[model samples]
Target: MKNEPRELLNNMFSAAVDAAQPSRCIAPFLPPPPRGRTIVIGAGKASASMASALEKIWPGELTGMVVTRYGYAVQCDRIEIVEAAHPVPDINGLRGTQTMLDLVSGLTQDDLVICLMSGGASSLLSLPLDPLTLEEKKNINRALLTSGAAISEINCVRRHLSAVKGGRLAAACHPAQLLTLLISDVPGDSAVDIASGPTVADPSTCADALNIIRRYGIAMPLAAMQILESGAGESIKPGNPSLASSDYRIITAPQIALEAAAEVAKAAGIPCHILSDRIEGEARDVGKVMAGIALQVARRNQPFKAPCILLSGGETTVSVKGDGRGGRNVEFLLSLAIALEGEDGVHAIACDTDGVDGRDEIAGAFISPNTLDRAWKSRMNPQASLDNNDGHTFFGGLGDSVICGPTLTNVNDFRAVLVLPKSADHQQEN
Candidate 1:
């Protein structure tokens, strides 16, 4: 309940994450029990938690399996939760995906298939198409991630290259009625873009994937190129009959998470303005723009005025040109700090709700009015750190890194900028 900058920002973030937790949001969207069988299958960072929630609430007997990222598994009475690597595919993910496909095969029309999907499913549900080895797929995935490509573009390529994605998984469950409950982490919450739309039809084509590869200059493997060039990797189109019995509901989304944070800010009597829930771009570039907006509100009192909190949610891409040790959230914060340049009365926090930014287990970092001053005092060059994309090191040096181990939910990035009035005399906390 503390209104101090650091504590308030952390509280808002926690609220945002809690609002999207599977247990809180998944119950209302559950489908009725089918006459024959209920099969639950899914893949994502939050899939296991969703399964656990469903296991607790479903009235009828259900059996299933779901794959989640390492360290994200949860216990369920009937459903099995498997752990797999994320942001890149591994043998465990490949086998898990295959097992899911096999599980849904030959189900009767009286059966019901419940799919719990969230962010990170693209990598967690990995199954490379023929002629494309898992190693090659991993290479392509790594390239696309570091290439500054937007998630939708990256997922487009992934859908084309995967054996189970882009509605193929839905198609595999043909006779059975499929109900997919999603925790959206992508901008706009497009059904086809969520985990590459494993249980929904895809409107994107192989040519579109090829165009994204060219746009990002991602080095594609020979087999990958062949799959795209020859159109052999085409995904299930929107009108495909296999998706006739498929339906999906976005149980929670970035907007809902942002609104939760806004409620926290409002409860503390601070005016809160939601910038947008779908802002997208390079992390540093987006940071610069946000910094400009914050500065305008701080100096000119334009926009939303001082003593206000600015909130936004979306996935930002990092080009990873520098061997930085942080994710997009930290990269955005570091750039924001550099751009703020020790501006007074401005504080901010940027973190991924899933509690892993980039490859680090840390969520993200916070920046205060004297963030640069503290860094300089510690012999840390803010500009140099930003250039090296080493936000984890920079923020960690100042004890500003926000660490919350694996929050079993993913709703993309959460950002809060607190701008106080110039005459106010509250010392920055974190």
Candidate 2:
């Protein structure tokens, strides 16, 4: 309840993360145990944690496998946990996907298959459709990521190119009652976009993938391009027979996470406003827009007045043009700092709930009224750093980078802007 902006922001972020944790959100949505075998299969940053949670509460015996990002594995007595790469496909992921498909195959109508999915599954459940090698898929993934493509567009291509995604996994589990539990990180929480909808039907076609590639100027491999061009890469459409026995439930999403953070702000006796849970754009651009909103609240106390906190959750993209470290959260904060130009009464924090931003272990960063002054004292150039996409280094140099390691769960980006009353003295250092 104190007037500590940084601590308050951090607490809010933590509340959001805690609210989406598999242990807390997965239990209520779990399906009843099947009469025959219970097989669990999944892949994502949070899949292992979901498995662990399900194992603890599931009354029936179960066995299966799930793949999670490196350093995200949780021990489960019944379900085997495999660690794999994320945002890019690797050999481990390919093999894991094949194994999962094999495990789900040959199931009976009386059996049940539980599929746990989350944000990183698109990369972690990597099994390219034949003729498109793993290396080729990896290259396409790298290109799409650096091209600043939206998550949905990137996933459209992935679904078409994957052998086990886009209802293919559900196909493998046909005849069995399949239940998919998802922790959504995508805008709108579209099931088909989460982890490319491994256990759900995909309405997108190969032509959609081709359009995204053309729109983004993404270079595709010859085989991959041919597959899309010839419609050989089309995903399972809605109402597919294989998916008839399958059902999916999104247990947690960005909106839910944002509301949890808002509750924290309310508990602290501060009015909170959630801008949107599905905001999307280039990271720096989003930051500039947020800065405009914060400035309005600080200068004129318009909209919602001062001494209030603004919360939002969503994923933003970054087109890599610089040689420095990058993360959307830090990029957003860096741009916000530049736009604010040392405006008093404005303090903000931006972090990825997964505790990893871009390729760095740092979650995100913080910015206060003195952020620019401190960077100037450290001989850092805010504009130059931002131009180079070096937000992690920029904030790290100022000792303002938020480092929380891996939170083991991800909803998406968490942004909190705390605007104190204009009359209050802004002497506190964060």
Candidate 1 yields a Cα-based lDDT of 0.92
Candidate 2 lDDT, 94-200, residue by residue in tens: 99999998998889999999999998999998899889999998999999999999999998999999898888889899999999999999988999889988888
Query: What lDDT would each prediction earn against the true structure?
Result: 0.92, 0.91
lDDT by residue (170-203, candidate 1, tens digit) is 9999989999999999999998899999989888
Q: Which residue pairs show collisions in model 2?
A: none
Query: Candidate 2 — worst ten consecutive residues by lDDT sum?
Result: 421-430
Error of 1 at 82 (Å): 0.6
Error of 2 at 56 (Å): 0.5
Q: Candidates' TM-scores? A: 0.98, 0.98
Clashes of 2: 0
Model 1 stretches with alpha carbons more than 4 Å out: 424-430
